[model samples]
Target: MLGSQTQTPPKEASSSITDKTKIKARYFMIWRWHFYAGLYVIPFILMLSITGLVMLFDDEIEMITYQDELVVMPEAMTLPVSIQLDKVQTMYPHGTVTQFIPSKAIDRANKFDVRLADGRSVLVTINQYTGDILGEIDRSDSWYQLANDIHGTLLLGQWGDYLIEIAASLSILLIGTGLYLWWPRDHASIAGFLKLRFSNTRLFMRDLHANFAALFSIVLLLFLLSGLAWTSVWGGKLVQAWNTFPVYYTWGDKPESHLTHADLNHGSEKELPWNLEQSVLPESNQHIHGAYTSSETDKGYVATQNNINIDSIVKQARGLGFTQYKLFLPQSEKGVYTLAANSMGGDITDPRLDKTTHIDQYTGDVLVDVTWDDYTVLAKLMAAGISLHQGDVSVFNKALNAVFCLVFVLISLSGMLMWWIRRPSGKTRIGIPPHFESEGLWKAGIAGLFVVAVCFPLASVALVLFGLADWLMFKPRR
Candidate 1:
């Protein structure tokens, strides 16, 4: 017995009472932090949610509401691109023509983009054949523009933008903490996981909140991430880091290469016999300035001759089987005339816009031609994503985005309800307790300092006041 007297298997040790108390205290602290923070963020969340939903179907709404104005003709005799530009210049003589959009739809004519000397860009739609001004679409009237303003700044400008950024950062933290709280202690029991009983009002509301949140958590996260990517400086850097491939411009010659007449093919067009010595570059010069002159006395820029009449161009482009066409006039001496076309409605896969031709401003010869099929894989993917996001691709995507917007609105409402229910009732609840009444004064002070350090520098001053209050009350109970 003595030999075996090995201390009766020392009673298995159990978790200490102190350990249990500490754990309880820690959980309470986290709960209190969440309650306070959630209460503060509810209003902002609601605003963001409502605005986001409205923006989701903006493209569809615009199309439906402004059908007559947005639509265009596929083929119509039009003035040359240069002449159209000249008309725009005269209309806004003090401004310069920036770009042109050719028509692909039968209802629309042509559009010219002009930049005033003051630096404001204006859109001017013109009749392709007669060069008659049709209408002007100002950015101020754009619903998408308004949505972006509200989504990014709550219409408050830079200060609002900063505040939203802070709110978004807090939202991420809130979501993480919320998920942690939702996790069950016992993995085997699914009792609370899928429960949605509506017998009790409070419980039913809780279930509704939790279930819907869980269902769309991933999508919400994606929206938040993409939005943050566009708002934050660091987020922009991250995007740039991921997009490392250089974007190439095939229409222009690189510094290391010299493109000559021999390097280019005229296709079906015959080269006119002209003085090569006068038109070609010097042996010592690497740059080429190709311009066609109809007469010695009539001096005009090379681009003037190459500019296609918008009305005639549209008719010819339609003959090529294009249902829609968009023309972009050059911005500078070296720029080329760009034409793009697409079908009536949007189709991501074959939405039909193509940068099919780039004509020389001087010779009126096609300088470059590329179809939709010729786009790089990344470019195509980007176009598709944009179309989907804008609700321009398919009805299905539009419906899905519409639902997403509604979900955002619901989320905001739920957040507001939760906050309204938990607002503190008294002044005492508004401030941290003094040291004499609460041992947590020091801890609270530390927390205040930490929050200020991370959130706003101005908060640091408030934190100092909190520390002073704690010192005055506690002073180490001697």
Candidate 2:
């Protein structure tokens, strides 16, 4: 038997071996994709986690860091909002009052956003009790604001936003592939799924990495989706447009306007709710000879009405149950007074209390008022997600987010440590996962990739480049 030519294996055995080989190849292919995604995402995760942690505690940090301005002793009596605005104006007479933020607590100062005649903006803080000019802070130069800017766009504006959006999109693939790799197979017990191994250093890091990733996968995905909703392409052009409120219906007769809520936004701070950022700010009807006259415009005709001052608008806002809100003054003759109190501005801890109202500058009529109940299902989810993402909902939420960010950091480092240990010794080239030619695996992957491409344009571009690299540089040696 030893000397005889080896008998041909059974057809079933041959097919079984081929099937197993295909499965192994598919697993390795997924691992390769995971490794590549992690490599690209590691730097971004580190940056975001650090910056996110800072932003999560922005209020606390500001209270401590800018104590002279942000913190004050409680007094029995406080100055009127109008009087405080007047005092601030007296100090910065050349500055135009853009926004008035009333103090939420007795110990806090009322803040006035002033745009100077020289085209510079500053946050003028006034002692609510004594009407003393506590300090003036250049909002742009705020440390927390810089952290926020870096978190949102790396301070590179649109280009940075695109880079971050792409990273976030690819991170989805990374999470998916990580979960697959973490899935247990042929396990003797639940230890692989639940217990982290510590006998070996490599095994410990591997298990830790896998476990943290698994634990925060859903949270990370929600955070990415919520963050992406504020992006230019997918969130702005696609999801946001689809979920926006029908202001025409809400306003009854839509007023003509050339500007949108986006104009109110400054740097990394979103002054309006995510759903209404692109909404057209309704303009007031112009006054004409004290007669109700019809006017012709692109939208339609509107009757002329009596105009009112900011004092009246402020009174109306207070009467309408706006306690701690931001009142944005009209930017132009026709611009409406925009009053907002929402999680976006960190004014309220509860997303359900989000309220935005557009008051007609000329008529003093409420043009459109949107509350949390008015948001679409998707929009509501986005609002809540953003609140949680920012840790503005509650103290518990803040602690949870802090833990999540720390866990993300640990996961990232553990992954790198595992890779360093497992990588080939003293090799100039990165030890790429072994390539196994499998048409079926590639076909499935391409199909899924097509879906991702459709959803994320920038990520699709990155994927294309990665695909080209895989086909050209990482092709199996002959």
Assess every candidate by TM-score.
Answer: 0.62, 0.91
Q: Write the per-residue lDDT of candidate 1 for residues 172-269, one digit (tens) a residue.
A: 54565566555565542244565775665545555556556667767666555545544433233334223222233333442221323211212111
Residues 96-186, candidate 2, lDDT per residue (tens digit)?
A: 7788888788788889888876666788889988889999878788778889899989989999988898899889989999888888864
What lDDT does the true structure give each of the candidates?
0.50, 0.81
lDDT of 1 at 297: 18
lDDT of 2: 0.81
Q: List the residue pairs that clash in candidate 2.
A: none
Whole-model lDDT, model 1: 0.50
